[model samples]
Target: MKSFITGASGYLGQRLAIKLAENGEKVHALIRNPKAVKTLEHPNIKFFFGDVLDNISIKTAMEGCETVFHVAALARVWTKNSDDFYKINVGGTSNVIRISQELNVSKFILTSSTGTIGPSLNLPNNEETPRWSSFNNDYEISKSLADTELLKHAANGFPGLIVMPSRIFGPGIASPSSGVNRIIIGFIKKGFAVIPKQSGVIGNYGFIEDIINGHILARDKGAIGEKYILGGENKTLGELFEAIKNRVNKNGLVLKIPVWPLSYYSLFSQFLADRFGIEPRITPDLVKRLGQNSAFDCSKAISQLGYRITPFEETIETTIRFLSQSEDR
Candidate 1:
């Protein structure tokens, strides 16, 4: 069957498209960047230059495609243009869902983020987790709203399923989520960091291949209108630093910073951003988010879609290797 994917130029979409093509499926990759056309070379893959923001482009690329993976979104924590997040994440999703329903595609998978799940301090979040009052940044807020839109539409007979992935890591395409690799490298290169270890802020992580597998499984077996979280290991910043230190052969230090200090720093960072158009390296939203526990349970995905999560240690090695090689190039 032919598949159409939005954000095919992105890390997840790129990996998904390549996998589909290698499996001998016809894949149409909707890309906003024209230069990406040459990079996505594959026998079974076709590049369609289009933006999800454009209704005509969506209709054109999705025509005759049996499966649609809406993977594109404004992924950064902050951008100079904030409204683009709503326009692309929410508006774009709405258009895709409408077109998919109109075309009656066999499956429509809306890629959502686990960022919508929680700032839960003690309890681990799951698919049943309630909406969060706090967000990491604009990206999370827009994505949360977009996810809501998908669920609302699904309740009204939209043939769509939401696949929420948590802290996905692996090789291929230096996309937005690949920032985790930089964080890893920094820990390896520099000695360590100062953070509030006691703060409940943490996350569940999964490798790219396993995440791709999760999406495929969800498409094949997921119940319509359901949201499935594709996640694996839950880890805190201190734990993550230790893992990196071990992987890179180092015994580093993790200095614990108070939450109030970080919040104060974020305020100064935001000031620079607003006055000089400089994107803040730290934001109050990010500090607040990083202070919350992001542990999640993917039992529903595991039981329903037969999802298998690769251990986080294994993924760290894979990611380090990829980043190292890319830097060498």
Candidate 2:
């Protein structure tokens, strides 16, 4: 099988391409940066330098491929131009879906965030959950729009599946998206970190390998126009950090920071970002999001797609081992 993948250089996309190539599939990976070509060097993989906005680029990269994995999107919390989120996430997704239909691609899989489902209230949010509130940032809003775009195409008989992953972490590319892995490493290496004091705020953490496999399962067994959440255990921030600390045998000092002060800090960070063009470590929108409960239920994916999640402790140990070896080198 010949598969075309956008955002092939990203944390998930890069590993997905490698896995497919290892499985004897011809992988056509679209990459915007020429330098990223080195990262995707595989016998069965070919790289194309292109942007998602350019139809010619996408067409050239996607030609003669039976399956399409549209993973490209603007996922940052804040950007100088907020319009960029809509352009890349929503507009780019529309372009890919249209082109996939034109080329008669058998499967079009989209990687969306579970944030589009909104925060959990009385129960953990699932694919069918109705969003009760407005989005906190442009990234969430744009991704929701992208999900809507895919649903429209799928409703019209286009073959498309959406996978929403939650707080993905594992040994893979050290991109911004790998927040869980980074936190583990930080706790192990630094022995100290500041965490929010919101003990009730929960988030579903998904292992990268499980989520990647879930993507493949969605392609093979998922129903048309259906959305599947690829997630693992749901735990609060404190519990998550405690797991990492306990696994690493590190007596880390976790300062439970008040939300109000963190909000003020992020506000100042945003001001600096707006004025001096310095990238803020955290933004106000991110602070607001972290304060909410983002837990999810993946039983739909488990029952329908035969999805399975690794034990939380096992995944953390494996991730810590990988990071330890990397640190030594």
Candidate 3:
């Protein structure tokens, strides 16, 4: 079997590539930068330099691959250029689907985010939940569009299965620099002591390994044209911070701020970040998102895909351990 993965150099993609290779499958990793090629080198793995926005690159990378895992996307809380988010998240996904269809891949697994499912304040969200009118951020909106595009293509006879994962936390293949890595770093450095006032908002979390496992399972047993929520435990931000504090043996205060005040602060932060072309530490979208309950239910995946997740405490321990080792290095 052959597997072609976009964003194979990313945290989840790299792990998936390794797992596929270890299971005796040939893996082709699509990366845009020539410098990133070395990181994906292995006996059973090949690297292809390609941009998802470029059809030629995508088409070339899809040739002879039996399974395609479209994992690459613009994932960020705040960005100066919102157009870049759409280009990479929406346009990139379209290209991947088109190329997969052209090559007749046996299965196409899309790495969608649970962000699109919106806040589950009243109840746990299932795959049947409709997209919320209020998107948390541009990243969420772009992903929702891409997910819709992928599903549309699937309806048109493309073998697509969407795996919607919640906020993933774990060690990275290359380095722990972004995504949950940032949070882990912050926790280790005592940067998140005070729980923002939106602490009551529910957050769904899954370990990277568990999320990758869910993706593989979705590829194998998922029904074509269906979406599966690959989520795990739901806990409040305050609980999460407490877990981190316990793991690090640090005492920190969690100050709760009202939503309105946080929103204004986030807006100011975003303005400053955009003016300087730097990533915002906080954004209005993020503030709004953090104020909502983002819980999700993965019963379908649990039963159909045999998906199981580690306990939240265990996940936190593993993450902290990985971060500690990385810091030592």
Candidate number of the best lDDT: 2
Who is ahead in lDDT, 1 or 3? Answer: 1
Question: For each candidate, C-alpha RMSD in Å?
Answer: 1.9, 1.2, 2.1
lDDT of 3 at 223: 95
- Model 3, 16-55: lDDT tens digits are 8888888888998888778766666679998888779989
lDDT agreement with native, every candidate? 0.83, 0.90, 0.82
Per-residue lDDT of 169-220 in model 2, one digit per residue for the tens?
A: 9888778887888787777778888888886689999999999899889888
Candidate 1 matches the true fold with a TM-score of 0.93
- Candidate 3 accuracy as TM-score: 0.93
Candidate 2 regions with alpha-carbon error over 4 angstroms: none
Ranking by lDDT: 2, 1, 3
| lDDT per residue (tens digit) for residues 1-329 in model 1 | 89999999888998999898998899989998887876688999988888888888888899999999999998888778889899989989998888888889988899998887766656778888786565667788889899888889888887788999888878877766765776766665676866775634578877889889888898899998999989888887777767777776467766787788888988999989888999897888877777667788899999999999888888888888877677667
Q: Cα lDDT for residue 297, model 1?
A: 89
- Misplaced by over 4 Å in model 3 are 173-179, 252-261
**Of the pair 2 and 3, which is ahead by lDDT?**
2
What's model 2's overall lDDT?
Answer: 0.90
List residue ranges in candidate 1 displaced over 4 A: 188-194, 197-201, 249-255
